[model samples]
Target: MKKTTFILPILVIAVVAALSAVFIVDEREKALVLRFGRVVAVQEQPGLAFKVPLIDEVVTYDDRILSLEVGPLEVTPEDDRRLVVDAFARYRITDLRQFREAVGASGIPGAENRLDKIMRAQTREVLGSVSSNDILSSDRAALMLRIRNGAISEASGFGIEVIDVRLKRTDLPQANLDATFARMRAEREREAADEIARGEEAAQRVRAQADRTEVELVSEAEREAEVIRGEADAERNAIFAEAYGRDPEFFEFYRSLTAYARSMQDGNSSMVLSPDSEFFNYLKSSTGGVSTR
Candidate 1:
């Protein structure tokens, strides 16, 4: 029993030592071996890694891409329009040694904090240089690209590579929303009014043209009727002249009879004339004496 206890303790100690001397790194991670607070070796590949037991430390970092979210930060664009912007960034640690050196004991958290500052600064700088319309437009891919480039350049010192930066949301402040809506409403109202005025102007032009056409038609018809009446009068006078040239006596008798019929149309019609006047010529017979009726 005494020998078994002594050998069992030694075996347990050896197993513990062996377990502490090595570690298994996942494929998604990179391990750094530090001895006495100094980096002694770096394991970028996966699988088993060796280290001195109780004398060395292993730090693992993610080798895949990581994401960082930036603020709903307020920015004033070139047009002096203020906007609230929400953004995010995608980054990866490129050099693990440089990363450790740059971030020191704080590790990923320290690197992220610094990266957040860089992203915020770049976001403000790039967005502020342009107009709010540009930021709110669908073509804002260029602006996002500019922010990413600036962030990548600044973050390089910390062994970070910024893949992309995107603005998730951009909007006017609650205080400005009502004002912008009112302005848009007024603009639409003005445009509607302009369209109505143009329609009325076109209607007036059409109405004036119709009125002119109506007047011209009436005047032309009156002119044509006057021409027809004048032609009729001329033809009747020519017929009268031809009848008078054919027979003077009959024409004179017919004229006298027509005058007598017109004068005696009313039963009470009377005339004052000398009997010897030629007005009684029709009453005289073929002889020189007066004829009884």
Candidate 2:
């Protein structure tokens, strides 16, 4: 019984020690063995790894692709236009030793923060070289590629492989949007007013033309009517003069008959005149005759 008790304790202790010395590294992880706060080995592959019991520490990092939201940043282009930029990056830890050396106790969070700085700086540099119009132009694809390349180049110092950098959104600031809208509205209003003024000018020209045409037409009609009336009076006077030359008595008698007819044209007319009045000469004589004065 005593021998069994002694062996059981020894076996239990050995089992505990063996279990602590061995660790399984998963395919999704890269592990580092640290002794007394110093890096001793890096296990980059998935398998069983061994370490000193109670004296060594193992730290694991993800080998899979990691995403980082670089967060929102602001920049001013060459034209002094302000923009709010949101970006993200895809990266993986390429050199775990270098990463651990650079960021000793800070872990992945600290490394990601550092990478964010690199991304922000490079994004600002690439976007700052051109005007804001270029950011929204067809060349924006090339511009974004340059930004990604710049971030990738700068990310190497931090022991990370930057696969790509992408902009989530690029837009004008809220203040700039309000100002731009105001300017657009003002321009539209000015254009509308100009159009109205031009329309009024055209209307005035048409009205003036109509008034002038009416005056010219009225004046021409009056001139033609006056000429026709004067010609009619001349023809009547010539016909009377020719008739008088053919016979003196006959002309006087005919004129008296016309005057008498005109004076008596109304059925209820009354006239007080002497018997020898010239108006009655035509009634007094059946023959064509006039009394001698």
RMSD of each: 7.4, 6.0
TM-score of 1: 0.65
Worst 10 residues of 2 by lDDT: 284-293
**Roughly what TM-score does model 2 have, to 2 decimal places?**
0.68
Q: Any residue pairs clashing in model 1, and if so which? A: none
TM-scores, all models, native as reference: 0.65, 0.68
- Backbone N/Cα/C clashes per model: 0, 0
Alpha-carbon RMSD, candidate 1: 7.4
lDDT of each: 0.90, 0.88
Candidate 1 wrong stretches, greater than 4 Å? 34-41, 54-57, 97-110, 130-146, 167-178, 226-293
What lDDT tens digits, residue by residue, belong to model 1 across residues 242-287?
Answer: 9888876677778888887787786855789898888778777574
